[model samples]
Target: MNLLKIENIQYSYGKNTPFEKEVLKNISLEVNANDFIGVIGHTGSGKSTLIKICNGLLKPDKGQIFYKGENIWKKGFDLKHLRFKVGVSFQYPEHQLFCETVKKDIAYGLVNKGVPEEEQESKIRQVLKIVGLQESYLEKSPFKLSGGEMRKVALAGTMVLEPEVLILDEPTAGLDPKTTKQVYESLKEYQAKTSSSIIVVSHSMEDISEYATRLIALDDGNILLRGTPAQVFSNTERLNDMSLDVPITTSILSMLAQKNPSVNTNIYRYNDTKAEIIRLLKDVKSIE
Candidate 1:
């Protein structure tokens, strides 16, 4: 199920001036249901700008964006309704928090969409749990929560909309390792439960490679590459050529596997790599 499609999209900034710059150029991609899309690139790659266009926050100067096979920018399209369906959690979601309490902030979008008050509380609680925020924090001021908690609360607000597609930009930035792991695992579990498609914009392959079904690489306003994490990571030289680095583990294993085939590390994921190593060691010992 292709949930969203972007075709020949182009965006320009600072129009009507000699300083005009075009960020995206002839970009086309298909985003499917239940797909975890990881977008990676160096800074200024137009990744954020592209996603903004997807959610209707920005209209591209050229090309079309489709939702469920229909041109989303067509006349009579309800962009507000589309936004609710494809929830976008920006790079620093907490910065958008303005309500008095975490509960109100999370419920803000739902309320704006006219969901009943009774359903609002239920939805808020459900999404808060989905983002791993305790019930106690619901009443607290979002301004006072820790960085990680604030990020989760921000995500909770977005999930309350029950969107079919979620576009999260650098959701795990500036968090402690434990909280980052928790946020990642929480979203993974939520995706498993709901089977919702998620598109994450991030520079760190290490953050999402283990789970993202596809990775899209962008650089200097162009889509440099797109494929499964393993497939994309295989082109280490290309990644470097674009000023991006593969996951540290992938680079380490890739170098070692070439020099020492006995390493037998054929996996790009952590658990799979560990298990493969263990199985190989047991086989080696058995032969001895």
Candidate 2:
């Protein structure tokens, strides 16, 4: 089932001023359970605006959003419940932390939602373990932790809510390679175990290739394309024209396929392209 749905969403910023801008124009999309969707686009493509609307942080000027098949704007709908159902981890989420200790920070959200004190403590322990943060850190100041540790603590804060749909905005931005790999892999593993739907908003082509099941491409506030990473990154010309870079991994395979058209390079993903190259070489050797 679709965990989140957007229909003909239209939104404008600074609406009555001379500088008014239309950010999202009739955009429509859906996120199903267990889907890791990577969203990318040019600078002004409205990527951030779209997500804010998706999570109900900002109401749309027009159109409707449904969560789990129920209209969110319907009479007396549970806004809080819906938010808990779809948790959003903002960019620089760590800075939002204000608690004296890591345990308090991670448990902040769960506690505010009125979960029993005992239940909240147990849930915090479970999520802290899930994110691989030690219980020892629970008593330490969040500001004193390493950058990666801080990111994990922030993520754990959100995860403790146990939302079915998780949205992360630029999760790996500004991290060292090793840190990025570890955090991303942790997220991937968590999804594998929980089958939670995740939407990642990032402009990094390589990250998209590594994490996204499907990639959504946007330009000038409109969706240019939506498909698997292999499919979206396969169109070299189109991506270039849109001023977006194809993943280096995809570019390598694309070059190989073009050098010998026998292996159609339209296959954009890394593993599939590798298999295709091996298959083509085997056939060529056999003929020789």
Candidate 3:
């Protein structure tokens, strides 16, 4: 089922002013339940604007946003309820963390929703572990943790609510390789466990290639492409025209194919590319 649908959404900044400029034009898409959607684009492509509209943080000048088939912008719609269902973690989520302790920070949302104290505590602990944080760290101030830890805490804050749709913008922007991998793994596990829709906006094609089941590429405030990773990454020239690159593994395969035309260059994921390389090597060995 489509958990969310955006229809002909148009949005502009500084509307009716000298600085007025449209950031999104005729954006339309449907987000299915349990979808892991990766949104990619160069700077100023309206990627962030599009997500904000989805989460009800920004209203589109023209179009309708439907949550579970109900128009979110309808006069009597409960926007607050929609926000809970479609949780968003913006870029630099750590900057938004404000509470006495990590526990409190993560529980703020649940508390607002009037979740029982016992339930809030249970969820806080559960989400902390999901984000790879130790139970001991829950008492520490959010400011006292490392950059990666802070980011994880911010992520845990959203996960505690168990939102049906989680939207993250640059969730792994400034972490070490180890932390980045852990974050991706945690998000994957979370999606699998909850069967929730996940939307991630990232610049790293590698992340998209590995984790996203679906990919959306935007340019000039328009969706240039939308498909599975294999389908979208296969259009290398088009992505390049929009100032984007395919995954490193795909690039490697492309180069290998140019050097030895017999090798398949159509693969996107690392594992698939690795298997293809192995198969080609085995075939050459058998011929020898």
Top-TM-score structure, candidate number: 3
Candidate 2: pairs in clash: none
lDDT of 2 by residue, 159-211 (tens): 88888888898887788888787777877777877889899988788877888
Ranking by TM-score: 3, 1, 2
lDDT by residue for model 1 (164-273), tens: 89889998889887888888787787788778899988766788787689999998888888889988888888999999887877766767678657764445787777
- How would you encode candidate 3's per-residue C-alpha lDDT over 100-194 as one tens digit per residue? 89988998999998899977888888888889999999899999999999999999989888999999999999888899999998898889889
Local lDDT at 93 for model 1: 90
Which residue segments of model 1 deviate by more than 4 Å?
Answer: 262-266, 283-288
Query: Of models 2 and 3, which has the larger lDDT?
Result: 3
lDDT of 1: 0.86
TM-score of each: 0.95, 0.91, 0.97
